[model samples]
Target chain A: MDEPPRSAPMSASVPPGGGPGRIDRRAIVDGFPLFVPAVPFGFVVGVAVVESEMPAVVGWSTSLTIFAGASQLATVTLAGVATLWAVAVAALVVNSRHVMYSAALAPTFRHQPTWFRWVAPFFLIDQVFALVALRPDGSPASFRRYYLTLGVFFYLMWLAAVSLGMVVGPAIPTGWRLDVAPAVMFTGMVVISLTRSPAVVAAVVAAAVAFLAAGLPDRLGILVGAGAGVLAGAVAEARLVNDRAITDEQEFTP
Target chain B: MNMSTAFVLTIVIALGTYLLRAVPALLLADRELPVPVQRALRNVGPAVLAALVVVSVASTADGGIEVEVAEVAALVAAGVVAWWRRNLIWSLLAGMAALWVTLVLV
Candidate 1:
């Protein structure tokens, strides 16, 4: 996907250059560890497809077409037995969190090309969002390179894992505890993101609410908790600004 | 379900999901958001990550939330390593190790 150093107009948005090759390499390295947990999760989705009696091809195709694991699991598991609308709604609601991810990323995507904007969201999974959101100041060119490289890497990895799962899924014992890996990965991600006090507030509040509302239907608690945490963090930030302003005024008056 | 029925359902779900994801970027492209919205968006990463942590580890049981001891051990170990080393791979390894050790002992 390298464009051979285009003219100034096209390349103007490029940051004080990381060299396209370097950024792609860095993106792959950064994405590798995060991508690890998805293997077992994909296996679960594959097992769901087998149990549902869906065609293996159709089950595998969802990995490419839908690309979101949770919803894919829901859709595959519920497809035949559930009402058509029920299956659709269940999957869509599971994926509704992507709306927030998209909104948060809109500003970064603002300066991207028309084609990039159109194609980029196709790969907007949780890991991609977390990685891009970490480097909010990246240039449009770098952003495109990093996002696509990482996206494709994850896509290929997921496809392979799910395929492997479909073959041996039934034989694998559930007690192997493949599930613990993703929880650990997510915990590490949360720790990495907690660089500021207000961010800590956000994480804590979000965790508390999500745990309390764990029974919410269709995973709506995820959204509800996240929204509350954002509000808490924003409120904390506004208060900090006000307090600093007050202290500054007092010093100036004296 | 028949292959054709599953195929049609897959297409429908995929289309709806695509719109949910793509519309925000297309509509808000290049537009500056309000200050409050920006502040909230800033926390979206941490907040969502935290929520995901809970979703992964906690599930509804017969009547209430049931969290496994091994998973919680994994989370604490991972959190400490992540904070101390600031490395994802190390933290992940630590958490997995902790999970297995706790499972064996318990």
Candidate 2:
């Protein structure tokens, strides 16, 4: 099948009622490419989940229940070794970054129908959020179709890839180092997602913070580090905006 | 944990994740957030993903500090491609291809 649409068609064929909403072609096509890296990552998760010795039901269930590669792997891996509380905490901390995405997406979701708002977050993974944030225009209108298309597209791809990986099973050796897929995927996403100077600053700060906080329990370091980076980026962004305002005023002096 | 316990933990974690995502989209819907807040939130994507990238590649399968050289090289390759192409599939394919070459040749 053709990949999900990469961008909203400048002109789409939506019928009736302020544009009759079908699943957005742009979103569907665009969303699937982001799934490329996740295919390997899902395979790795599938293998790891199996190795964790959980029953097949529990193992496969996570792919649907969590719908996130990293956090699902973290939770499954932790289950065998850590206490349930520790596992939950690690998973929660891993998922905490979604809070930032959620807040960032709030403006877009605001205009969406109540039912859409209720269900969309279920698909709010890093890839989807990055795609939304990178839009040049950043308009909230018509986001529902884009968001829904991306979500549905990603959900099916992830589910299929992971389930396939599980059936392929542990025959794939660790020496292959397939575990690196998530980092590779995320690295690509990060590079493409960066647009402004503050974004660059934020990435650097976040990496430094994560490195420093490495020993924190339950993988809480990611949460703390992400927070620090955002705060620093905000400061930088604010300063830049202030400086730009001053320059504009000076240029316009009458 | 047993299957039942593991299942329950997964459910709880799922609930926590859903709420984290839902709360903001629900509460902050239909209004312009403060500019500073919006600015901060905009950068959150880069910050969080960067952090995850580091967290993932910095540790080994056994949780050691030593990361594989091939994996690091592959990740760098992927990042460069992503930046240069600005396309997800191309970068990922480039990364995996680089990884294959590195593992085979290096």
Candidate 3:
């Protein structure tokens, strides 16, 4: 893959030049830990994604649309080889991890209100989770502000990094063609993220399913594999719960 | 991958990903996540990631099983770096560097 290097001045999008401090700076600062990996990761993804089949502009938008790194990358790569449905399914499953994030933060956000509930979770990425998790219990209003500020801050950083990444790609001639820059940078970050694994059964089941379906058109094999893995893992999980119940019963009888 | 398709997918994914995040916040308030549900959800991450990796590696651009040694070597380098350093940036950097080196040297 041709790793397209981003233009250097993309950093110009960083702080001070943009005087928009709606959210608390503290919340934004809280996300600093992620800056290291995220910046480079965003840039790399942008480059790889542009290298894929998607156009520069569409590739860039995944940062906001999906807002998750790994899923965004999967979306691009899958889009390159598979159909839209395949890409969509893969993106959803990859991001299904956020279901946990949403559930974990649900209690914290429950009191906010209908509109807030609807809009707030849109910003709930891993960094936001980190910031929220670390926070000492506080008033709901303060919590909302804190979360949104960090959300905005993280959003800006991601956009900028991706935008910076685009500068390295083609078609951006550096004369303030805003669309070109934004599109290219977003493309830079499309490569995406994964960090963990499961037991032998889930892996084995999923691989088998994917392999079996590998011949299906539009790369639908992975969807079948993902479904099977989930099914198998669910069975495993339920079985473990059952075994635990049996053990408890035996102990009580003794 | 027409421009319109890319645009549509981007919009759909944005909507889909957003709904995935928003629905739980709207609906799951005050309810305990059932054990089975939690377990299944937990597995979803690994299953999807694993499935993606397998399919991605196995199915080439032409939908055939062929391992590009250069890409595989880079991926291995990335996996090792990520696990060893336990840092995402370093892992990616190491992988990219390794891929570049492998491409250049061998």
Better of 1 and 2 by DockQ: 1
Off by over 4 Å in 1: A1-23, A246-254, B61-64
Per-residue alpha-carbon lDDT of candidate 1 for residues B20-96, written as tens digits (9 for 90 to 100) = 88999888877877766766777888888888789657866333568989999999999999999989999999999
TM-score of structure candidate 2: 0.84
Off by over 4 Å in 2: A1-21, A137-141, A246-254, B1-6, B30-32, B61-64, B104-106
Give native contacts recovered, as a fraction, per prediction.
Answer: 0.75, 0.75, 0.53
DockQ values for all predictions?
0.62, 0.59, 0.44
How do the residues B9-67 of candidate 2 rate in per-residue lDDT, one tens digit apiece? 88888888789888988889878667677778778888998887777666444444556
Q: Which candidate should be chosen as best, given TM-score against the real structure? A: 1
Task: Arrange candidates, best lDDT first.
Answer: 1, 2, 3
Assess each prediction's global lDDT (C-alpha) against the native.
Answer: 0.81, 0.75, 0.61
Rank by DockQ (best first): 1, 2, 3
Best by DockQ: 1
- Score candidate 1 by DockQ: 0.62
Model 3, span B14-36: residue lDDT tens: 89889888888778765655656
